[model samples]
Target: MVSIIFVDESFRSGRVCWIKDIVVAVTAENMEAMRSIIQRYRHKRISLAEAGATRHRSIFNGLKALAEDQPDVVIIHDAVRPFVEEDILLRVVTAAKEHGAAGAIRPLVSTVISPSADGCLEHSLDRAKHRASEMPQAFLFDVIYKAYQQCSDYDFEFGTECLQLALKYSHTKAKLVEGPPDLWKVTYKRDLLAARSVIKEKISQEICVVMNTKDEESAGHLLKEVLKKELNCVNVTSTVLDHTGGNVQKFPTDQCYSFICVNVVSSEFQETQKFLSTLEESGLPLLYPVVVVLVHCCDLTLAPLASKMESLMWIRSLAEDMKKRNVLLSGLLLNYSKDEQKLQESFQQGASIIAALVKERSSALAGQLLLA
Candidate 1:
């Protein structure tokens, strides 16, 4: 699924914004499914149009549905290009309002060569002069709608460029706006992995650490302090995980995807399982992978390493099950020391491990337990 996150940095309450409504155009067979998926993310009503067989036809159908609204400007975006930024959207919309049409452009990576009839390279176009046309294009609604109305069958069948139609029918030249590198579309299997990595990095910026006990002197609190130092760039917050998980519920599910569950007095996986349950009930993992690092601080004088490992071996199985739900659960065993210096060192090491897990968010280390 193509996941999109819309951000308006200049948004203000009670102020008019360029985006009035969002509409998704999909095949008739997938309309209902798309509606359900959109409803999960957006509570407000979003219009859905039945798409046509071809690219231009689908866009034409979407435009036809907006005829009644008669919006001043219409922005066209490819669902696969989920990394589109708000700056590009604003620039295109503003340019389109003035120039009648506008579209994003990127520098071409390779030379465009023309092949001869015998399959040999006949000529090559100057790559420096040409730019790749990209999505997040905008047009005057009336101008594009009229252009589509006059489209021939061949145009709907094979024509992919919307700017060309505007220029051909309305004689409107599109203002080309340069876009960022992240505007590239997800087209291959490797692109899917890249998309996930980008999404993971975006969501990993904030981490909510949950402590099972309310004690200020608990090992969880110390870990939280070290985490703050280690992940200085990250926004980290700590809260006591009560029976109802009220504090955790206070955190907006959309903002944070990484969680550190500190189990000091309780049994291993008890607090982590509770946090995971709250996350599961909220359906946050459905949007992206939720990283939950289960941290257990053990005093070797009290609990032997072999016994602790044996008791916590069940986490491997639980991690496997949670992985299916997009919850990456990992365990960290920290050797507790009475000396302040040694304890601080252990906390620092544990914080480093947590930072790596949260940043990379690799599923390969989900079920493994790391010692600090």
Candidate 2:
């Protein structure tokens, strides 16, 4: 919510990279993982602290460790809820500043029941009257810290609610904010699988560019130059692959989030198809959505735009087929102008749209074309 950075702690498999400062609290057994992640981030705002055995104790320990930093507000989040959004975080923080404590809640989906000693249902709770408390809870720094100090050992060992603790010790009534459906925590094995899929979709940021040959005058080469500035150069790579099914040499070894294929003519998509074939055969595991942007460059002053539009229609059909494999296909018609200034402006705009497609990890433009 504030302009800070938060990086994910790599445990078994998942990864997260966000913009916020972070203090990771882990159990003593997970100290090794914490050290490895801290080493990777290497930032002054990022630090580590040991957690206690129980949930409330762990949170208290984390707050105690942060006494020196003296943050204005402290937000407590569970690592399992990977889909916490920026808007929800902002809501909790603002409410906490106004009300001293705040937490997220979702409408209960099922009725809760209590069983008798003989195993028969004794009572049933009205689902409409209850809500499920979710995470990304926030509190005023001083309010929560002092509340923890006043907590009894029994509360520390058995208490599960931070808002209740604040209310009991600091007399602070917590504000409840409704959160989105994606705020569910990963509590089971199947939940982890869902989290993995969500992570793959949102974290696809790396991109690669493919061109037909080594010609500097080619459209792909010129576009790649502009893209390098729009995206991180380390995440963008360029290489040559011939149209006659030749191997694509000199590409990045790591996974690519998107592929930009540049072609001078509208009908020449064989090289792009061959590149896709090679990718399928390489056997490298692709867990994220991969975008394939087809950029067709032609001088619009010399050729009629109507004639070129027909050749690009094939892309729509091809895109529909590629969707089955989780591949998105989009087309960009770079209608170059004879005027140097107009051509330069068009190139800049084209680069921006391509960069947006990659960064947003969006498929809104799939099976569609833009005239740049």
Candidate 3:
């Protein structure tokens, strides 16, 4: 029997700003397929069109419905749990199938305190005895749903936990496992930087730049070739498009995401400024919140960054403009480094700036569809 995974969260449903009402639901025969779906998107020819099994309702009724339609097993997780690795998911599902219930947990990082009668003295629980519950909670579908069905309006209106609900009525004990620190929920502004850092680390080592640069009147083709040799894991592909006027012939539906550039090259700083200034006035492509960047530096000397910040200042300033549009943007100066290895590293790093930016916003939004 296939297991269903429920990744619940309120993401910026249509507009990429306020995350008020949204939930993504999906099901896979096993955990490996669930992970491959994420890794496969590195190429530009993947599809993330899975049908969601169940949808979360506003308030607490969402869980109530999951309990109504009992299945083999239901795994409720947080979409904000981007750091959730596949192995962690495998362990929980397997355990739930065997023991009827399982959940991921971790040691608390903060003290647990409650207020006293008159703001004087309260009690605090020993942190060692308490566990901070993370997500990917799994259970035999029937066992959990029945518990919800038996719940009163009080339970249905205010319940914030699945494990506690299972424990209260089904009398099931959840087998808890430690989770990685990155599994921390993204609830504040600081977390955006942390999320970007994680993506940067992942792209530094393994990346493939497959492109069709046959019709370029410029140096994008040459950049791709040299970039392949410099970065250890970076792969490059540049072939002629078959009557298609695009770098990537197919829209990646699964593993990889795409970031397309729509800017031309110029030498004079004023001309470059004029080119980018038009982006602010033009909203043709700015309709989407994710910002887009146009790189102008194809040839510049790489002298330890500090020696040449003026020529690159245009790119930095442009990145700021793109930020307002919600797209993180930047420019790269393709220049010779005195150290041959260092020059190559510079080129590879430039390519990664674009690749990694694409991966972060390609989350598949699950809706309407139900589980098997």
Candidate 4:
């Protein structure tokens, strides 16, 4: 099933304060699975409605189930299209409240042609003059519910478009609003791959760098600056992890999936352990694989390379343990230097590695260590 992220932006306007509920219509065979998945979001009011054989029936049933709630507006969306933005939803709902109905539309990509009875093309439509209807449609609750109540059996069995029902039965012409390119639906095997790639790209765009307050001018801060240059398009944020890990608690709530814990003051993994504990306590990793790159920066002149590596070798076992909880833990050892040029070179190398680990998010390198 496609996972949809619902962001409530309705607080910005008085028309819609919050999403009252989310109704998912699914087949009987998939009802248990859907319920199991929906249970994860205890904070949201989500329920499942029994789906019918036809698409129109499924939608009508969903709307009928919500009639008792007497909501001001109803937003209908396809579960297959998970990339719908919050702004599009808000616009549709606001427009529906004013115009009685509203839906998203995109410019037709190819010319839609009419075929004759003999299966040959009879005529072609002007693609520039027509638009492709998309999901995230909205309507005034009474208008859509009454339309479904009055629709015929033939329409319920064969009809696919809900906007047409509102126009034909309720006399409500739906307002067509333009949508973005990412509103495409997942329909094929290749589309699943594309959706996964898009999701990974979206989650990797933000990185949170956690370090101790004592290392403000240390290699950790330098690496943070270099990372900003390496991943120019990504949002890089740095937070100080105090003894209580108070400041580091906000990253998970901010939906930051990538993290780099810079341990510059100690050879042991005390800072990294504290950071991981905070993340575990939040239970954010249970939803998605959290990319955690533990960076140990030290000046090799003061410590032997063998002893330093042996001290941190325990991270490999810890990484394996964290991976069980959906946390992708990896280690980076950066040889800190006193020379200006040497330090900059080392930080650049570490920055590139961190960027790759965050972007790919491969499980294969979960317990491995990379040296720079």
lDDT of each: 0.78, 0.73, 0.50, 0.78
Q: Residue 364 in model 3: shift from native, Å?
A: 26
RMSD to the true structure for each prediction, in A, is: 5.3, 11.9, 12.9, 4.4
Per-residue accuracy of model 1 over 172-204 as CA lDDT, tens digit each = 999999999978978899999998888778888
TM-score for candidate 4: 0.90
Steric clash count of candidate 1: 0
lDDT of 4 by residue, 1-372 (tens): 111112111111112337767777778887777666656533356666788888888887787778777788888887677777788988888889899999999999899999999999999998889999998888888898899999999999888788999999999999999998877878899999998998898888899887766556866688888999999999899877663435656554457899898873344466567768788878777667889988888887888988877777878888998888888998888988887787888899999999989988898899887888
Report the Cα lDDT for candidate 2.
Answer: 0.73
How many clashes does each candidate structure show, in the order listed?
A: 0, 7, 17, 0
Q: Give the TM-score of candidate 2.
A: 0.57
lDDT of model 3 at residue 253? 18
Models 1 onward score TM values of 0.81, 0.57, 0.51, 0.90
* lDDT (Cα, 0-100) at 222 in candidate 1: 82
Model 3, 70-147: lDDT tens digits are: 446666667676676666767777888887888889898998888788986488989999989987777877767767
The local lDDT score (0 to 100) that residue 337 gets in candidate 3 is: 45
* Ten contiguous residues with the weakest lDDT in model 3: 363-372
Worst 10 residues of 1 by lDDT: 1-10
Worst 10 residues of 4 by lDDT: 1-10
On the 0 to 100 scale, the lDDT of residue 327 in model 1 is: 91
